[model samples]
Target: MAAGRSLPCDDEFLCAICLDVLCQPASTPCGHNYCKACITGYWDSRGLAHCPICKEVFAGRPQLQVNTKFRDMLEHFKSMRAAAAADEIPVGPGEVPCDICVGPKLKAQKTCLACLASYCEGHLEPHLRVAGLRKHKLSEPVSNLEDRVCGRHDKMLELFCEPDQVCICFMCLKDDHVAHQAVPLEQAHREKTAELRAATSGLKMMEKVKSSSVKDIKGSMQRSKVESDSDVSSINAFFSALAASLKCRQAELIQAIQEKQEAAEAEAAGRVAVLEQEVAGLRRRRSKMEQLLQTKDHLRLLRRWPSLQMPAHSEDLFAPEPERLSDNGPQFYAGIVRDAVARMEKAVNNEMELLFHEVRLSGSCEALKHATAAEDPIEDLIFRSMPKPEEHLRMIQRQHAVDVRMSKCDFSPGFVVSEDGTRLSFLEDVRFCLPEVPNGESQPPVVLATEGYSSGRFYYEVQVRGLDNFWVGVVNPAVSKKGRWILASYMNSWGCFDASHLKKLSLKRKPEKVGVFVDCDTREVCFYDVDAKTLIYSIAGCRFNGESLVDFFTRLMTSDDSNHRPKLYPVFSIFGSHSSSELVITPVSPGP
Candidate 1:
């Protein structure tokens, strides 16, 4: 009975005497439980020891003892009750709490939309028992119960209004949503859930594709790094060999100098040995002569002079001077070194140029250029996966071509029209003047064809071989051909500029010819690269038929034209300083 506690208990756990939960519970012989105090008081008040539940009598005074096991069970129940009370969650502000609960309201488990009330488990038991309450609709507890019921009719909201996209009550079907497309709420929920699932599936597929692309890019980067490392290693080895050769050449040069010095020293030592021998003879003779002067060896001295005769002392007895080493040898070697270096330099320069050319030829340079030019990271990734420009063009063309003619009217002063009227050129001005109009706005060069189409499909080819900036497309009859700077800028016109500004139709190569196809019935306009047979860009869902023309004329407050149906004229705009550039409306090539 504690607040916020809804634990159920058996009747046996209650004291029969006090009609309350048991305390110090004890059992009688009749197997009925009672509080010890309550049982004892009942027996004493009756003046007899008897079981109150079964009417069993006890002869003499029965020995009363506390039931220890029952006391333990009562203590366990008390602990659990206290724990449950502590675990109870108090209702907070703005939460749907039990309406029937009085004191410290409990959080509601469910709400009955019919009764417009929320109930906690304790108070909700009545809904399960009472037949009337059971008939009420129940749903997860919500804060705004009134929103689930219609304000006008006071009925539960059960249907969905598809036209207005709102939840409607049952009464709405007979009232506001009677003519509207209404369906059961469950059907709408199912359809919306299915759509979400499909979108999720598509997202998952895209994630897989992006993940695979990332992996491929990483793998390519790793391979490129490996190739670069290998190239570095080869370059290092080449330089290392060159250094070793230089060192060997240096050692050879030093050895040649050492051999020359040894040869010169040996010749000088031989000459000096001959000179010393001559001096020895002269000394022997002089010694004998001195002995004779002393008279005791006069006979020996005279005999030695005749026999040896004095050694001839000539002025030619001189050592040969060693020649000064010349710088010629070293200079010759230096020349050889310089020539070797020059040859190596030339070879390296030529090899590097060849390698650079090879890289360019491999299309790596083009790929790198495009990657750098891309504005977005995702766009760059997609661009890398695209096929070659020629291949893409071929796929779009599908061999489609058409005959077209240049317009004569609205020609700017700088242009030259061909004699046949099939070609238009922005040739250098010779002697042309601009026509003065009432409006101050000067017209940029533009032209429109006389023929137009309001129904059926029509195709044409325009040769834009030398032009850099030009426009091509079909325009509404109301387009300002006199002073309009851009064709696509106007609401009734559709044009693609062959310039960087129009990224979708930016051409890598100056298309020699362009094919324009227009389907009036479908309101589709497509441009193709004629030579490459590639589709450039397309504008679909255009409004260019009879109805659109009528609307356009209506807005201008003008009557219908002489033609039964309004027609769209092929238009062109050209602006360039060079007169040589020409825009020729050429006929389609004959089919094979």
Candidate 2:
């Protein structure tokens, strides 16, 4: 029955025994007391024989007490605390001790309800005891007293009317409401009090809903804390596994680098040692040859008499006969020495070749090692599996157009002509005309003739006034078939032209101020739908009058009125041959 250090005794109150609050109260048993449920529950499952409170041996069940006296004492203490709190009035609760009287003041007496005015009790005697005050009923001061103003005049309540249902000053009831219907303030107050009760009931309902929502929010916050802790643990576990994997990979990479470095160093050292040994052998051979040359016989042979004659001096007679010398004498010795030196030279050359071969092999090994160490394995694998350079190049060549031909024109016109022979030209001052036809394929046919102007591009200029006759089309020979004519022209006056065959130009009304014309006649006057590639309008069997090319253009481009005077012939033609006849087409602006 002894209490565990970590576990609170079952006999003890779950509520703090020292504070004696009843929250989750429990009990303990002894001559001394504690919470009843606390002691019973603490020893319920234990098989010990001692009491939890006193640790005394008990052969039988010890009786647990509820300690009602202690609980009664706690309740009394709480009541006393509440009563004490209620005895003192707060300074802000519409009531306070009177400053002048030095005594507690009743909030109800501070202001006279009948007079509808505020005054301290010390100053309120006149309002209560005045000549007609005995019939007045006073009320406790209200914090919202300022809100009870005159409804009609929006002024502070200064008097209460006995007849009208309103609070008002004497002057208001006497003059402003002389002939109006009114009621006494007491009657109005009763009605307003009922309205106030209804409003307060509605407010209570709203407050209850708001309090319930707040409790739900608190519960949700606790759940969110639990979920957050679980998420943190999961994240930690995942990153720990990732860290372990990364550590393993790092160790492997480091080991591989170390092994490669050691192998390369050992190989380099082996090559250096081989070269050193070969050099040392060469030096030894050279030293031995030098020593052989310094022998006495060899020196004597080199210093042999300049001439074959007997010495004149007797001292020179001691010199031995050169013919009686031993077979292995200076000459034979010289031959053997020369043979040995030759053999040593041959051995040195062989050793040098061996050393050079090792050096070359070592250099190749180092280059291979660097390549292996530097290249990423994945990249190397991908590169090795890729298509050959020649094959890749061939594939690209097959898929793309290497050589293609585009349209070229020798000369082109820049105007549009109507079937009525009215030609409109747009002379571009700073702009170049592009064939409006799709891909310039269905452009009007015009005689493109070159002249002294050798520049491949054509330029012209024209001026337009408000909503008058304007030029709007394009012409290029590259888009026109030979002997076929195309024109895009509009006029203010609508008219139909009679021809053997006709086609209309379906050009977009782009509000463009320029047009180009190309001449390549095949006897058919065909008008193209520039953007659509279909024939929009055409005129066939129109005779090509043999007129001067320049005169024809000049007449067509000139304005009909003299006042406008068509400032300049707004058209020019690049004629390939001066002798050919060509038709021109013109475009007009569309209506809004």
Tell me, by lDDT, which candidate is best: 1
Query: What lDDT tens digits, residue by residue, belong to model 1 across residues 177-242?
Result: 899998888899999899999999988987776676566666666766787799889979988997
Q: Which consecutive 10 residues in model 1 have the weakest lDDT in total?
A: 483-492
- Candidate 2 lDDT, 1-592, residue by residue in tens: 0011123232342243333545323344335454555455555767653555468767777665456666776566556555644643434453533332335543334644555654554345655568777566555555555566656665556555545645674457677667655555566677678989999997787677556545655665566668668977997897799689868975885586567667767876777797688669667756765665667785564554333223366353355633421233346545765797697666556445545444433422232333344344553453243333233222222222111111123223443333343333332432223334322343322322222121111222111212222222222222223222223233322111221223333344422233221121222233333322233344443323323346545655885423211110112221212122232333322211
- Displacement of the residue 526 alpha carbon in candidate 1, Å: 41
Per-candidate TM-score against the hidden true structure: 0.34, 0.30
Task: Quickly count the clashes in candidate 1.
Answer: 6
At residue 112, candidate 2 shows an lDDT of 49
Q: What is the C-alpha lDDT of each candidate?
A: 0.65, 0.42
